[model samples]
Target chain A: MPDLFVGVDVGGTSVKCALSGPDGKVFHEGSIPTESHEGPEAVLKRIGDYVTFLTNDIGGRPAALGMGLPGLVDAHKGISRYLPNMTTHWRDVPAAAILGRQLGCEVRLLNDVRMATYGELIYGLGKPVNTMVFIAIGTGIGGGIVIDNKLRLGPLGAAGELGHQTIDPTGPLCGCGNHGCLETLASGTALAAEGIRLMLVGMAPALHDAVDGDPGKVTVEVMGAVAEQDEPVKQAIQHAAFYIAIGVANVVVAIHPELVVIGGGVAKLGDLLLGPIRHDVRARVGRLFPVDDIRIENSQLGSKAGVLGAIALAIHGLPA
Target chain B: MPDLFVGVDVGGTSVKCALSGPDGKVFHEGSIPTESHEGPEAVLKRIGDYVTFLTNDIGGRPAALGMGLPGLVDAHKGISRYLPNMTTHWRDVPAAAILGRQLGCEVRLLNDVRMATYGELIYGLGKPVNTMVFIAIGTGIGGGIVIDNKLRLGPLGAAGELGHQTIDPTGPLCGCGNHGCLETLASGTALAAEGIRLMLVGMAPALHDAVDGDPGKVTVEVMGAVAEQDEPVKQAIQHAAFYIAIGVANVVVAIHPELVVIGGGVAKLGDLLLGPIRHDVRARVGRLFPVDDIRIENSQLGSKAGVLGAIALAIHGLPA
Candidate 1:
C-alpha cells in the first residue's frame, strides 16, 4: 500500500522474503526452502521467486531491496567472503547484482548480524540509546558495533568480529580457527555441547533422559527445559552465562557502549540465562571504567530481526 | 619569525620546555630540575618561567601552548588526573587554567603518549596511515590510539592504556594492581627488573658485571647490551618481546591497522629490540586476515616525540 521495500534473508535452511513499507513495517512475509542440493543458480531462482511473489501480491515492484546473509560481506563491492559452511561455489558472489537484475529493484546487501544490529539500532531498544552492540549467539557468535547511531564499518569491513577475539588462548577450537573465542565457550552451541558432555558423564539424569541418549537432541532448547528442573543443566547455562557476562563486561570496559542487545536461540532462555550473566557482569565490571549503567537486554524485534535490519539498510544505505 | 607555540614535556626527573614556531621548527628549549621536592607550586613556576621565556623570546605570546604529562589525563577538561611520583599536587588539576593564566595563552594538556600519537599522526609516519597505534615503553608502558584520523578517546579518556592489557594472568605484579600486564613484562622498569632477576639467579654474567652486583644500576640499557651477548638475558628479552609482539599481532589481525609505532626509552635498542619483536610477531601472525601486510616499526619522532607531539595537539585539537 505504502511505498514498498523488499527485505531478503538468506539462511542455510531457507530463504525468507518480506515486503515492507519505507517505515520498516512489514506488509507480507514468506519463506521457501534454499534447496542447496540444487546449484546456486537454482537456489537463487527460489530466492527470486519469493521476491516476485511479494511484488505480484503488492500489485507492483518495490522501490528498494535489502538482503542479509551469513558471510564476511564487502558491502561496498557487493561480495561475500569467508562465510561458514555455505557451498564453496558461494565465494565472491555478486549477490546484489544478480538479485537486483532479477527483481528489477535496487538492492543493498549486508551481514546478517550487522543487519540485526541495524534492526535494534533503529526500531528496537537501541533507538533510545546512542551506542549499542548487538550480539547474536546462534549457529555461531557474531556482533555489530553501532556508535553515535551509525555502524562502525571498519576500514576493511572486518571491525565488529568481537566474537573472534580470543577469550581464552587455550580455549576450545572456534569455527574461525582461533582458540578460546567467546563463541567457542558462550554461544548456544557451547551451551548445548556442555550439556551433552555433562550428560555423557552421567551427571544429569533428567537431561540424559530428555535427550534419550541422543547427543544431538541435547540442544539449548532441551537444556532450557531441563534447567526448569535439573541443577546440572542450570549450571551449564550458568557457567556459559558467566563467561558471556565476563566477555560483555570486558567489552563495556573497553568500548563503554551504553547498551548490549543480546539475541539468538540461547537468549530465548530469557531470565534464566540473563540472570546469571547479569550477576557475573555486575561483580567483575571493571572498576576503572565502571559501565554500571550499561543495559543488557533482548532483541525486541524477535525472529524478524534479520529482515527488519535489512529493511533498515534499504532505507538508510541505498540512498547514500 | 612565524607564529610560536610552547611545548612542555613533564617527565619524572625534569620538565623539558621548548618554544617552536607554527612551522614545527624548534626555536629555544630548556629543562629545569622538576624539584618535585619543592612541590606543585614550585614546579608550576618553573613551567611558567619556560612559558615566559618562550613568549618573550618570540616577542609576546604567539599562540596556543600544550603540556604533555605521563599519567591518566582527562583531555576533554584539560586536566591531568593522576601521575604517580610526580608532585603536581595535581589531584584533578585544571592544568589549562594554571598554564593559561601564567602565559596569557590558550593551553591544552594531554597524556604524553597521546600527544606523541598526535605528533605522529600530524607529521610522522602516521600521515600515510589511516589507523595508528603508538606504544611508549618507559617507566610504565603507555599507549595512544588514532583511527580514521581521529583519536580514539573512549568515554573516560582512558582509551589507549595498552600497557595495562593482560598478557599473562599470573605474571609479575603491575602498578595497576593487575598481574601480568604488558608493562609488567616489557617496560624499561620491567626490563631492568628482568635483568636484576637474571643476575640474582647467576644467569646474566655481563649484566652482573655491568651493574657490579648493584640491582639499582641494572637498567634496561645495560640489559639491552647483555641480551645481545648473554644467553640468559637474551632469553628474557626474547620472552618479553614474544608477548609484546604477540599483542601487536593480535591487534594487527583484529584491526588490520596500517601502522604500529613503537617508542619510549627502550626503543633505543632499535633493531636489537625490534628484530626479535618482529620475529615473534611474524610467528603468530594469523592466517585469517591480511596479517603479513601490516607494517611494524619504531616511532619516527624518537626522543623529541614529546615536544613535537604537544605541537600536534595545537595544530589539530585547537578550537577552530
Candidate 2:
C-alpha cells in the first residue's frame, strides 16, 4: 500500500482532515467539531484519533501529517505562538510534536492562510507563477507570499500580515491595536460593520429587508444580495474595495508579484469587489511598474485550500 | 593578473564607477557627469569608454560588469524600460547588451536601489540577514527586498518601490500618480517641501536663515540643522518620521524581514528622524508580531551604497 499523507486544517468552529496519496489525490476526507473550548490537548488528541481511524479504514500507512493552524505559528519550532480566535489562544503549544507523537508520523505546521497559499501554489492559480501573493479576506485579512517558487516564512514565521498594513493613518483603530489598518477599512468584518451601520441608519433598505432588520445577520452575502438595488450597499463595497485596493497596491509595489490571488468568504462577492480593486490597483501602480501584466483574480479552492496546502506540506516538507 | 569586476551606478546627474576584485574589495573608483542630455547611446558609450580606461590603468581584463540604473529596468532582458529621471526617459534601451558588447564582458543590470540593497546584503549590515528591506529616502523613496538571502526583482524587475506604497489614500498627489505615497510624506523631497512651506510661511526662521531666505535652498540638511531650534522644523521631521514609520511597519508586516536598513540622503538625520520612525513602527506593529526582534537602522554605506552595491552585483552576478 502506498503511504498516505494526512492533512489537517483546524478552524475555529471545526477541524477538517484529508488523506491523500503522494500524487495529491484525495482518498478520504472528514470533519469534526473543534470543541476548541475543550482545550488544545483534547482537540489535538481527537484529531489524532480521527486520522488514525481514517488511515486504518483506508488500509494505508501514514507517511507524514501536515496541519494548518490559525493565528501566529512558529513553523520553525512547530509551536503555536498565539491563536487569537482559538480557546486559550493556543499559546506556546507544541502542536506538531504532539501530533507527530500521537500519529506516529512526522508532523509539519504552518499558519492556516499560508497553508492555503501553499495549496494555491501547488494546485491552484499560483502553480504557474513564480511570485505570488495570496490574500484571504474573511473576518480579518491575512496573506501569504511566495517568491522564487517557495513560500516565504520570514524570520519570525509571521510574515505576510497583509491586512494589518495601515491604509489610513487616521482611520479607525484596528483589533490588532494599530490605527487605520487595512483590516479596519476592508475585510469581511469591516464590510459587515458597514452593513450593520447602514442598516441601523435605515440607509440600506434592501439590506434591512434581506436580514429582517437584524444587524447581526449582516454578512458579505447579505451585502452582495442587496448591492444591486441598494445604493448604500454598493457604496460600502466600493469603499471596502477602495481601501483593499490601496492595500493590494501597497503590496504590489513592495513585492511586485506576477499574480495576486484573493481568497476567503468575502471573495465570493467576485467581480463586484475585485473589479474596483483591479481598476484601482492598475491606476495606482501603473506608473511604477507594468501593472497591466500582474494578474489579480479570485481563488477557486475556497475552504479546501487549507487542507490541500497541508497535503502539499506533507508531500514537500517545510519551505526553505 | 586576476580579472577585475566593474560596477557602475548611473544617476540623474552623475555616473559613479568602481573596479573591484572578486572578493568585493574596491581597487579604484571614479565618476563623470551623466549629462543625460547626451542620451542613452552616448551615455552608455561613455560608460564603456570609462571602464576601458579604468581597466587599462589597472592592467586588468574586465571579467564582468554590473550596473545599477535609475528608473524602470528589465534586468532579465538587460533593458532599461523607462528611466523617468533621464532626459530621454531611456525607453526600451538594451543597456546590458550594449555595455557587454563594448567591454567584451558579461553585463548584469538592476534598478539602482536594488543594486544598493544587493550591496548592503553582501557587504554591509544586510550581510548577516537572510531577509532584508533597504529603503533609500532621497529625492524620492525607493527600496529593495532580499528574500532567502537573494535580491527579489519581481517579474518586471521592479519589486521594491517601498516609497511608492500608499500611506494616505486622500493625501496629496505623488509624482508616481498615486496619492499620499510614503515618498510624498517622508522622502528628502517631502521634507524639503515642508521646509520650504515653513520658510515661506515664516514659521521656520532658522530654516530661512540657513538657506538665506531662499525657498529653493530648503533641503533635508537645512531642515535638520534648524530642527534643534525650530519647532516647525522639528514638527516637519516628526511628521515625516510618522509616515515613514507607517511605510516601515507596512513592509515589516508584509515581508517580516530580520533587518530594515535606511539609506540615502534623508537617513543622515540619523536618530532624530530614525528615532521617531522606530518608535512609531514599534507602536504600530508591536501587536501583530515580534517588533522588538526586527532591527531598523540607518545605512552605514551612505552615498557609496549604490556604487558598492554595484560592485557586489558585479562580483555575485544576478540574484537567483
Candidate 3:
C-alpha cells in the first residue's frame, strides 16, 4: 500500500485537513470548527482529533503530516512564533512538536502563503514555471515568492511581504504600522472601507440600498456585487486595482517573475480586479520588459490551496 | 604565470576595457571613443580595437573576453538585441560572434547592470551576502537582482529595470515612455531637470548664479553642490530621494535582499543621496521587517564596477 500524507490548514475559524496519497492527490478531506476560545491547547486537541478521524476513515496512519499556519512560524524550529486569532497564549507554541507527537510521525510547519505557493508551483498553475510571485488579497494582503523554482523564505522568513510595500507614502497607516502599504490600499478590507466611505458620502446609493441603508454593512463582496451598476463601487475597485498594480509593477521591475498569481477573497471579483491591474501594469511596465510576456493569473486551487500546500511541504520534507 | 581576462564596458560615448587576473585584480585599463555616429559596425570595430589594445598593453592575450552592454542582450545567443546608446543598426548584432572571432578567445555578453551585480557579488561588498539588489542611479536608473547568490536575469534578460517602476500613475512621462517612473522622478537627469525648473522659477538663486542663468548647465553635480545652500535644489533632491526610497522600499518588501548597494554618478554625492534614502526607507519599511537589519550601503568599486563585472562574467562563464 502506498504511504499517505496528511495536510492541515489552521485558520482563524476552522481547521481544514486533507489526506493525500504519495503523488499529492487529495483522497479525503474534512474540516472542523476551531474552538480557539476554548484555549490554545484545546484547539490543538481538536486539530489532532480531526487528523485522527481522517486517518481512521482512510483505514491507515499517514507517513507524515504537514501544517500551514496564518502567522509568524519558525519552521526550522517547529514553533508558532506568533499567530493572530489562535489565542494569546499560543505564542511561542511548539506546534509541530505537539502535532508530531500526537500523530506519531514527523510534521513540518510553514507559513500559509508559502505553503500555498509551493502547492501551486508543484500541482497547480505554477507547474512549469521557475520564478513566480503569489499575492493573496484578502482582508489583508499576503504573498509568497518563488525564484529558480525554490520558495524564497528569507533568513527571517519575512521575505515576500508584497502587501507591506508602501504604494502611497502619505496614505493611511496599515495594521503592520507602515503608512500607505499596498494592503491598506488594495486588500479586501480596503475595498470595504472604500465602500463604507462612499456610502457615507451618499455616492454609492446602490450599495447603500443593497445593505439596506446600513453603511457599516458594506463589505467587499457587497461592493463587488453592486460594482457594475454603481459607479462609486466600480471606482473604488478601480482605485484598489491601480494601487495593486503599482505594487505588482514594482515587483515586475525588481524581480521580473515570469508569472504573477493572485488569490484570496478579492480575487473572486475576477476580471473586475484583474482588468484594471493588468491595464495599469502594462501601461506602467511599458517597454522596459517584454511586459506583454508577463501574465497576471488567478489561482486555480482556491480555498484548498493552503491545505494542499501543506501536503506539498510534507512531500518536500520527506527523506529521499 | 597567472591567467588574465579582458573585460569591456561598452557605452554610448566611450568603450572602457580592463585586464584582470583570475583573482579579479585590475592590472591594466584603457578607454576609446565609440564614435557611434560612424555607425554600428564602426562602434563594434572600436570595441574590438580597444580590447586588442588592452590585451597588448598587458603583453598577453587573455583567456576569455567579457562585455557588458547598455540594453537588451541575448546573453545565451550572444546577440546584442537592442542597446540604447549604440546605433540603430546594432540591433540583433552578433556581438559575441564578431568579438570572439576578433579576440581569438571565448566571449560572453551580458547586460551592464547584470555584469556589475555579479562583479559586486563575487569581488565587492556582495561577497558575504547571498541575496542583494544593486542599483545604478546615473543619468538613468538601472538595477540587478541577486537571489540565492545568483543573478535573476528574467527570461527576456530584462529583470531589473528598477528605474522604470511607476511611482505615480499620472506623473510625467519617462524616456522609456512610461508615466511617473522612479527614473522620471529620481534619476540624475531628473535632478538636473528639477534644478533647471527651480532656476527657471527663480526659486534657486544660488543655482541660478552657479549656472550663470543657463538652466541647461544645471547638472546633477551642480545641483548637489547648490543643494545645501539652495532650498529649491535641496527640496528637489529630497523629492528625488523620497521617490527613490519608494522604489527601494518596494524592492525591499518584494525581494527582501540582505543589502542594497547603490552605484553611479548620483551615488558619488555619497551621504547626500544615501542619507535621505535611508531615512525614507526606514520610515517606510517600519515593522514588517526589522527595519534596522536591512542596510543600504554605497558601491565600493564605483566606475570600475562595469569592467570588473565583465571580468567576473568571463570567470563565471569559464568551464570547470
Best TM-score among the predictions, by candidate number: 2
List, residue by residue over A4-88, the lDDT tens digit for candidate 2. Answer: 9999999989999999999989878889999989999999999999998989888888899889998889998999988888765
User: What would the per-residue lDDT of candidate 3 be over residues B16-105, giving only the tens digit for each residue?
Assistant: 888887777787888888787787667777788777766676677768888888878878788888777555546788888888888778
Candidate 2, superposed: residue stretches over 4 Å from native = none
Superposition error at B275 for model 1 (Å): 5.1
Model 3 residue runs over 4 Å out of place are: A1-4, A35-41, A56-59, A84-93, A101-104, A318-320, B1-4, B85-90, B318-320
After TM-score superposition, what is the CA distance of residue B288 in candidate 1 from its true location, in Å? 2.7
TM-score of chain B of each: 0.93, 0.97, 0.94
Q: Using lDDT as the measure, which candidate wins?
A: 2
Which of candidates 2 and 3 is the stronger one according to TM-score? Answer: 2
Best by DockQ: 2
Please rank every candidate by TM-score, starting with the best: 2, 3, 1
Q: Note the DockQ of each predicted structure.
A: 0.28, 0.80, 0.65
Query: Which scores greater on DockQ, model 1 or model 3?
Result: 3
Model 2 - which docking category?
high
Question: What would the per-residue lDDT of candidate 2 be over residues B175-220, giving only the tens digit for each residue?
Answer: 8788888888888988899889988998988888898998888889
